[model samples]
Every structure is written in C-alpha cells, then in structure tokens.
Target: MTRSAAIVLLLLSGCTLQRPVPSEPDATPMRIVSMNPCVDTILMEIADSKQIAAISHYSQDPRASSVPLKWAMQYPVVSGAAEDVIAASPDLVIAGPHVSIQTIAALKRLGIPLMQVSVPETVDESKKQISDIAARIGHRQTGANLNAKIDTAIAAAQSGAPPVSALIWQGSGLVPGKGTLADELMTRTGFRNLSSMLGLKKWDILPIEGLLSQPPAVLLAGQANMGAGNADSNRMLSHPVLRNIGARIKIAHYPSSLLHCGGPIIIKSVARLAEIRRLMEAKP
Candidate 1:
C-alpha cells in the first residue's frame, strides 16, 4: 500500500479499537425502598410515586405519617424485612439511623445502596437534615422553601409573651429534657423547658408525685388524649396535691409522629404548639 493508504488504514484501525463512551451515571432511581417512617415521608414528598417500589406499612397510618392513608394504600410495602426488600429489587433503600443494626448489615451484604438519616435534635439540625435529604433526591428548592416556612412559623410563635416554664410529657410521666428535639421545639415556641432548667438531658422519668409538688407553668402533653385513660395525666390533674398549684396546666396534643419525625412536618408541629400557647395566654 502507498503511504496515504497506509495512514488511512492506521486511522481506521485506531477508530475501530476505541472504547465506547461510558454511559452517564443514573440520576433517577427506578426502584426505591423506604424502611423508616421518616424516610418514607421524605421520599414520598420529593420523589415521584412511580419511582418508589416499596414503603413501610407504618406510612399508611395517619397518626404515624403526614401522607394520607389513601395515598399510602396505593403503594406496595416491604415492612423492612430483608427478604421482602430484596424481592422488591430496589435501586436504593432509605432508613433512619435508629434502624436495627442487623437489618442494615443484611442489606449491606446484599450490595444494596442505603441512605441513613438521623433524627434531628435541634431546629438547626432539622434544617440541615432537610437540606441534605432534599439534595440527595434533587429537591433542594423544595427543602429551602420548607425551611423558610419553618423559620417563619417559629418567629411568629416566639413574637408573643415571655417564655413560660413548661414540661413536655412524653409518656408514663417521662419528660424530654435538654438536648432533645422536644425540648428544642418547646423553646422555639416560647416555653422555657423545666427539664432544661433542672439541667437534665434526655427523657427523665420523674414520679408523678414529684411533678405535682412543683408543677410547671404549663404542661405540654404529646398526642391529645394520650394519657387521658392512663394514670399519668389523670394523676397530674386529679392528684390532690396538684389541685392547689397556681400555674395553668394545658395538654398540647402534638402527635408523636410529627414530633418524633425530623421531616417537613416539624413546621406543622411548631405551628400547632404556637396555637396552644396562644390559647393558654387567653385563659383566665
């Protein structure tokens, strides 16, 4: 072959030997499995319904999730079982930091991609987590909007009277102290958590009798009618020792789901608590 023909052949050979261009990383997850209630709420909010392969059954309960039961009923659920999750063939799995270690390990062993979210302990942390999740799902704008709403609600709530001494009743006379999201929420709503005043951290189990002796200015109960039939609330209100306390006691029924979950619904919880605080201020 002549020089030009040889050069042409070399070029053709090089072209034929070139590797194909790598495909772009898949930005859209085709199948998503949510193992935690909070994760389920976030995924539902940010991702299309068709992108989700399965969710936890707890998402079906209105009490446990902000999503309507009807909406939850429309989707299949894995209930966080390893076998069930594997069967769903999810491209991604979402769970909370508190999920069972064993389950996490099992999923890892199967080479499943897992995203673990932490529960927020403060308003700042809550905002950060929301932004993080939103970015992960390509919903950063939605997250920013939700954060703004939360800040606005908290500011509105705090604009009123000086902080009142308050107690957050979790259950069985257990109250969330300092270093808890409940405590942070109470503070954001213009209440000085008595637990924080006492320098306590986490949920402290106090005898109902002790609370009666030194009642707070306001009693904030999680979940309306939570302890109504139980001995806790009844004991707090009906206890003869508490009858003479001058402070106004009110039951703020913030659903555990809203309070416990670190998602967009936290703004709703803050708004509800603000309403309760206003009611308390109006009372004689």
Candidate 2:
C-alpha cells in the first residue's frame, strides 16, 4: 500500500497505540500541518521537528515568512487545500482567521481537528495565542520559555530615550493604526506611530498627499526596496512624487515578515526597532 493509504488505514483502525487520543492530557498531534504562515512559525518553534508534516507554502518564501528559510525548507509546503492535508494525514491542522470558509468546511467534513487562530491586536493577546497554541500542541513548557524571551526583548526595546514619530507604510499605502500589534510594537520600541499621532483609526489608509504635505521624521517602509521590481508599479509608494518626500524622511526598511504575525517574530521586530531608533539618534 502507498504511504497515504497506510496512514488512512491506520486512522480507520483507530490506532490509539500510535497516536495520542483526543482525550489524553498529552494529546499531542503526532503529525501537524500548518495552513497559516503565523501558525507555521509557531509549530516550527514549539513542536518537535519530526511532528511537522508540512507548513504553509508562504513559509518557504523569505519575503513573507517569519521563520528562517533554511529551517522552513526542511518541511513540505501546503497550499491551504483540503486534499493536501488529507494526503499528509496530519493529526491536527492549524489555520489563521483569514483562511477560507471552504477550506475550513472541507477539513471539518473529513473529521480533521482544526485550530483557528485569531488575529491578535495587543501584546497580551499575542502572549495568550502563544500559550494557547502551545497547550493545544502539548508543549506548554516550550511556550512559556518562548514567552520569556519575548518579554525580555520587549523590556529591552522599551528602554532608552524619548520616542520619535514614525510611519509604518506597507505596500500600496495601507498602514496599521491604533489597536494593532504593529501599533503596540511601535510604542514598546520607542517610536510613536504616526498613524496614531494623526488620529487615524484602525484600518485607515495613509493618504500619500497628506504624507507629502506633513512628512514624518522616520518612515518604516515595508517591501519598498528597489528589488521589489514591478511589484511596486503604479503604487503610490514608488511614485516619483513620494521620492522627494522620502528624501527628507529617514526611511527605515521593516521586513513584512515581521509585521503581521505574532510569535518569535515579535522579539525580532523589537530588536530591529531598537537598532532603527539608535540610528535615528545618531543622525545629525
């Protein structure tokens, strides 16, 4: 029999001796397939390497993944398809809030266990997510340890001098405003979020004309580098008018991989912010 067929047979036979039963206290998933990039990082960090059957295809892309490419490449990539999950025969499938309803429904129909992680808006929410996922995957201790590291990094990043005004300008002009993890990170890292400074609410677009009229001292542009190629074509970010405005601003490049997700990425973002703040201080 093929490997997938054997796995399906094992599942059908109710092989309690090999896999952890749902009611077990150590109900760890013997095989895990992550459908979300954020979940991919969490699983990679808290679960044993052998337990991971596959991670999101985005995890293998450096531009979108929080995990190192070398490490992420060690696992197979899933495209959020139910068939892929079935072929992998993972004991647990983890997805993000944005996953399609069709995918979720398909998984449920196949009697697969699913963990949907909500988008965290605050630091406390992020911590809770880490703890929740860890416990679900039977890695409570690992989760606690990772939280300690994030807390320490946040403390260190919080230290230093007064905050500076900065704008986190993602591609096409979308900006994370108040009540978002990005907003919280900015406050912790000694940089005031210009979106909040301008009284912009959550999910508000940062107007290019407004930005050019009253430029921030620092611009945290994600995915705006020249190598981004035609990806920035016709986008206000790469428009010639903004170039003049960008020249007067200290534009610091923040990785998009570190922007959206909550996991070990938080610690990395905090550290990167510290370096950026230091550079701004050193300027004439």
Error of 1 at 152 (Å): 2.4
In model 1, the clashing pairs are none
Q: Report the Cα lDDT for candidate 1.
A: 0.68
TM-score of each: 0.78, 0.84
Worst 10 residues of 1 by lDDT: 16-25
Candidate 1: list runs displaced more than 4 Å.
1-26, 222-248
- The top-ranked prediction according to TM-score is 2
Backbone clash total, candidate 1: 0
Residue pairs in clash, model 2 = none
How high a TM-score does candidate 2 get? 0.84
Candidate 1: lDDT of 21? 25
The worst-scoring run of ten residues by lDDT in candidate 2 lies at: 16-25
